[model samples]
Target: MLKKNNSTPLYNQLVDVLIEHIKTNLDIDEKMLSEREICLKYDVSRTTVRAALNELEEMGYIFKRHGKGTFVSGLWKEMQNLSEAYSFTEQMKQLGKIPHSQVLSLEYIVANQDLAKNVGIQEGEHVYKMKRLRSADGMPMMYETTFIPAYLFPDLTISKLESMPLYELYPQVYNQDIKYADEEFYASVLQAKESEELGLPAGSACLRIRRTTYSQENKIIEYTLSVARGDQFVYKIRHSKK
Candidate 1:
C-alpha cells in the first residue's frame, strides 16, 4: 500500500509505489495492471493513475502499445548512447550484432522545391531517393529516408547501400569527403503513415532525427530523416562544467 505521508504530491507518491512493485515482483514479460485496476487497488482516481503512468512512460520505465496495455521496458537503459553520429550498421557492429537494411523503395526522383531547399540542391535537379527499414538482429529498429544529390553521385543505387555504410561509400563513389555534419533531434508521436512503415502502433512515441552531412568545402552532400523506436533508443548528451 502507498503511504499518504510524503513531501511529494499524491500522484508522485503513487508513481513511486507502482515502480517499487515493478522492481520487486512484476515479471518483465507480464503486462502491467491497467489504469482502472491500478486506481481501484490504490484507492485513487483514474486521473491520478493516468498522471503516474505518463511520468513512468516518459522515464522509459514502461511502454504501452495501442490497445495492448503497458509493459515493463528495461531495455532502454542499455541503448542510452544513441547521440553519437554512427550509422545503424556501425552502431550495431560496436554492440557485436550484424546490421542489415531491407531496401523498401529506391528511385531517381526530380527534386521538389521543398527537398531542393533543404538539401541545398537545385529545384528540379535529379535526386536519388531511397527508403529502407533498418533492422538489428532481425528486429526492426528504424525507418529512414535519404536524399542524395544525384548530380554529385550519379551511380547511387539501393544495391550498393545495402552492402555498405553511407559514410564509407561516400568517399569512394562520389569522392566527397565528409568533414562534418549537423543534426537536430526531437520527440514525436508516430503518424499513421510512419507507423505503417515502421511496424509501430499509430500515435506511438518515437524519435525524429534530421541530419545533413557536409564536405570539406562546406557543401551539403546528403540529407536524411530517421524515425527510431522510442523504447529501444535514447539520445544522451554528456556535459561538464566549463
Candidate 2:
C-alpha cells in the first residue's frame, strides 16, 4: 500500500513501486493494470497513478499503443537517448553486436529547394545521397538515407561507405570534423517498399527520425532520414526544469 510520503512526490513513489514489480517479473503478460486497479491496489488517486504511468511511458519502460493499454517494452527494444547523435554502427557496437550496412542506393542529385535548405546548400547544388539498410548481428534494424553536400566531400564514393562508418570517413577521407546534430522524431507506419526492404511486417509502426548535422562553423553538412523498427528501438529524453 502507498503511504503518502512528503520526502518524495506521491507519483514518484508509485513509479518506484511499480518498477520493482516489473523488475521482479510480476504480472508482465497482464502487461498493464487499469487506472482503477492501480488506485484500488495502491491506495492512490487516479491522478497519481496516471502520473506514474506517464513517467514510465516517457522513460521508455512501457509504451501505450493507441486504443491499446500500456505494455512493458520487451528485451528486444534497444534503449537510446533521443538527444544524442549516433551512427548505426556505433549503436550496434555499444550493444556488443556486429554491425553491417548494405548499400541500397548511392548517387548524386541536384538539390531541390527543400533539400538545399536542410543541408545549407543552394538550390541546384549537387548533393550525394546514400541509402543503406543497417543490420545488427545479421538482423535488419534500420533503414537510413543521408544527403551530403558534394562540394564538402568531393572524393567520396560508395566503396568508402561499404568499408567504414560515416564518422570514420568524415575525418579520414573528407578532412571534416563531425559534430553534434539536431534531430526530430515521430511515429509512422512503414511503407510497402520499406517493409519489404527491412523485412518488417507490412504497415508496421516505426520510428522516423530526421537530423541535420553541423560542423564547428555551424555549417550544416549532412541531413539524414532514419526509420527504425518499432519493436526493436525505444528512445528516451530527460527533462529538468530550469
Candidate 3:
C-alpha cells in the first residue's frame, strides 16, 4: 500500500509498484491491467494511474496497442548510444537505476608487452590495475578490468574510488580531463570467472569492449577491457551522411 502522507508523489509511487510487478510477475508481451483496474486495485484515482502508465510507456517498460491494451515490452534492458561519450554511472542515473561498483582488486603492476602497446606506454612502466564489477539496481551487468598509468594518477586509492565514479574523480581529484576515447567491440562467450562475477552461467554470450581513453594532451590515460551481459544492453550507433 502506498503511504498517503509519504514524500513521494502518488504517480511516481505507482510507477515503482507497477515496475516491480512487470519485472517479477509478467512475461514479455503480456497484457497489463487496464487503467481502471489499476486505479481500483491500487486505490488511486484515474489521473494517478494514467500518469504512472504514461511514464512507464515513455520509459519503454510497456506499450499501448490502441484498442487492444498495454503490454509488457523489454525487461528494462539498458540502451547505450555508441556515438557519444558516456559514463556507466551517468547512464544508469539517466535510466532511473541505482549504479554500483564493486572493487574486486586494485594493485600496481608492470605493464606487459601487449598491455603497454594498448596504452601506448613503455612495456616496463608501472600501472594501476583495477578489477571491478558494475551493477545497476543491484543487478550484475558487467565485469571490467582497467589499467591506468601510475605516473598519471599516483594518488589514486580505494577510498577515493569508492567515493565517486572514476570519470568524475579524474577531473575533481587529479585535475585530468578526458579528451576522447576509442573503442572496439567484439561478440564472445563469457569465461567461467567472468560469468561468476556477472552472475551468469559460464559460456553465456557476452559483448567484450576495449577502450582507450585519452587526455586533452593526446596521451593515453586509461585502458579498460569490459565483459557485459548481452541481454542487459543495446548498443546503437548513428551514422551521418558524408
Candidate 4:
C-alpha cells in the first residue's frame, strides 16, 4: 500500500516496495508482476509504474528480456564508487562475494608508444602483459588486461596471479606498494570476442575503464584496461558541499 501523503514520490515509493519484494520473495530469474498488474495493485498510472521499473532496472534489481517480463537479477550484482581505489577482488570481498580470476594470457612484451605514454615508461621497454577474466561466485564479471614494467617485477608469473589478487602480491612478492591510481571511464559496446569472454551478447553495453597506478614515490607501477558488464556493475560518486 502506498501513502499519498508521504514526502517521497509515488514512483519512488513503488520502487522501494518492489525492491523489498524482490529481496524477500523472489529468486533469481523469477518473473515479476506485469506492468498492468502492478498498476492495478498499486492504483498508479502506467507512467508511474514504468518509472519505478526503470529505476529498478538501473539498480540491477531486475532485468527485462525482449517479449518477456522483468525478472530478478542474481545476488552477485555490485556497485562501485568512483572515489575508492579498491581492487576488484577487494571490492567483491567487501560486498560478501567470492571473487576469482582466470588468467587468459601472461607474457612479456615491448611497450609501444601508446602503451608507454599511458604507463609513463619509455618506448621499447619490456613490460609484462597479463589478461584475466574476473568473476564473482563463479559468474563472469569483467575482463581486464594489465601491463606492468618487467624491470620492476622480475619474478612475476602467471601462476602467482591465478592464485591470488595481484595487488596482494605487490608488497609481498615485489616489495612495491600501490599508493593510488588515476582512472578514466567511458561507455562502450562489447565486441564479439569480449562478449564471448564475459558470457554476454555482442553489443551489450559496458563500461571501459583505463587505470594508471603509481607507487608511493609516484613511479608508474601498472596500467590496466578493464571492461565491466553494465548490467551488473554501477559506478557511484559522492559530492560534499563546501
Candidate 5:
C-alpha cells in the first residue's frame, strides 16, 4: 500500500516497492505484473506506473520489449571504474558471481596491415586469434576476441585460456609482466552474430571496447576487442580537484 500523503513522491515509492518485489519474488527474465495490474493493485494512475517503470529501466533493474511487458534483469548491474585493471573473473568474484569463459575458436593467422598497426607488430607476423564468450552465473556478459603474437607465447593454447585469466598466465607461463594497458570504449549496437552469441536481441545497445596491453619492456603483448552488454555494465569515473 502506498501513502498518498507521504513526503515521498508516489512514483518513487512505487519504484521502491517494485524493487523489493523484484529482489525477493522474481527470477531472472520473469515477466513483471502488467501496467494495468499494477495500477489497479496499487491504486495508482497509469502515468505514475509508467514513471516508476521508466526509472527502473534506466537503473538496470528491468528491461522492456515491444508487444511484451517488463521483465526482471536477473543479474545486478556491474560497475567498472576506468582507472582500474582487473580480469573479468576477478571482478565477478568480488561481486560474488561465479564467472566462466567459453572458448569459441582459436586460430593461427598472419597479421594484416591494420592488425599489425593496432598490435604494434610487424606485418605478416604470426598471431594467435582467440574468441571467447565470458559469462557470470550462467548469463552471457561479454564476447571477446583477442590477438597475441604467437612468437612471444609459443606454448599458449586454448585449453589454458579457458581455465584461467590470460593476465595470470602471462606471468606464470611466459614470464612476462603486464606493465600497463590502453583502452577505448565506444557505444554501439550489437550485430546479428554478436547478439546471437550473447543471447541478446539484435540491435541491442552494447559497449565496444578495444584494449592494447603492454609488457614490462613496453612491447605490445595483446590486442583485444570486446562487446559488453550495456544494460549489465556501468562505468564509473571519479574526478579529483587539481
Candidate 6:
C-alpha cells in the first residue's frame, strides 16, 4: 500500500516499492505483476501503476514483451562494479547464484614481442593460452580468453584451470599474492565465434573487458579479454573526490 498523502508522488512511491521487490524477489526473465494487479495491490490508479512500470523499464530494471507482460531484465540480473578488482566466481557466489566456467581450449604458445612487452615478459617466452565460456545460474554471460605466463605457473594444467576461477588459485595454489588489477571496457559487437559461444546472435552488441592482473611485486600474472552480453551486464564505475 502507498501513502496517499505523502509528499512523494504515488507513482514514485510505487516505483521505489517495485525496485525493492525486484532486488529481493525477482530473477531475470521472471514475469512482473500486470498493471491491473499492481493497481489493485498497491491501491493506486492505473495511470500511477503505468508510470511506475515505465520508470522501472527506463531504469533497466524491467523489460516488456508484447502479447505477454513485463519481466525482470538481465541488467539487474548480474551486475559487475568496475570500481574494484573482481572475480567472476566470487561475485556470483556473493549474489547467491551458481557460477560455472567451461574451458574450451588450452595450449602453449610463444609470446610475440608486443604480447611479451604488454604482459611484462620476455619476447618468445612461452605462455598458456586458454578460452572459456562463463555462466551464472546456467545462463551464458561471458566468453573470455586468458593468457598466463608459463614461467609463473609452471605446473599449471587444464584440469586445474577447470576446477576453479583462475584468480582464486593465484594465492592458494601458486603462492602469488595479487597486488592489483587494471581493467578497461568498451562497447563492441559480438563476432561470430564469440556470439556462438556466449549463446547470442552474431552482431549482438557487447561490452569487451580487458584486464591485466599483477602479482605483489608488480609482475603481470595474467591478461584476459572478456566479452559480456550488453543486455545481461550493467557495468558501474565509482568515482571519489580527491
Name the top lDDT candidate: 5
**Model 1 worst lDDT window (10 residues):** 75-84
Enumerate residue pairs that collide in model 2: none
Query: Candidates ranked by lDDT, best first?
Result: 5, 3, 4, 6, 1, 2
Better of 3 and 6 by lDDT: 3
> In candidate 6, what are the lDDT values of residues 85-158, reduced to their tens digit?
38888777767889899998999999999889768899999998989898999999898899999988997888
- Displacement of residue 23 (Cα, Å) in model 2 is 25
Write the residue-wise lDDT of candidate 2 on 154-224 in tens digits: 96788887877888888777777876878899999999999998998889999999988888777887899
Candidate 3 lDDT (Cα, 0 to 1): 0.87
Question: Which parts of model 6 are misplaced by more than 4 Å?
Answer: 1-85
Question: Which window of ten consecutive residues has the lowest lDDT sum in model 3?
Answer: 75-84
Candidate 3 per-residue C-alpha lDDT over 1-242 given as tens digits, one digit per residue, 9 for 90 to 100: 88889999999999999999998999999999998899899899999999999999877789888889899987356423342546889778877999999998899899899988888889999999999999999999988999999888987788889998999888888888999988899899998888788889999999999989999888888999999999877677654353
lDDT of 1 by residue, 5-50 (tens): 7678778998888788887877665699998999889988899899
- Which of the predicted structures, 1 or 3, would earn the higher lDDT when compared with the native? 3
* Candidate 5 C-alpha error for residue 42, in Å: 64
- lDDT, candidate 6, equals 0.86
Clashes of each: 0, 0, 0, 0, 0, 0
- Estimate every model's Cα lDDT from 0 to 1: 0.83, 0.82, 0.87, 0.87, 0.88, 0.86
For candidate 5, write residues 186-236 as lDDT tens digits: 899999999999999999999999999999999999999999999987776
Deviation of model 1 at 127, angstroms: 1.1
Model 6, backbone clash pairs (residues 3+ apart or across chains), number: 0
For candidate 6, report its TM-score: 0.65
How many Å off is the CA of 11 in candidate 4? 47
| Per-model TM against the reference | 0.63, 0.65, 0.65, 0.65, 0.65, 0.65
| Candidate 2: RMSD to truth | 11.4
Candidate 5, superposed: residue stretches over 4 Å from native: 1-83
Q: TM-score for model 3?
A: 0.65
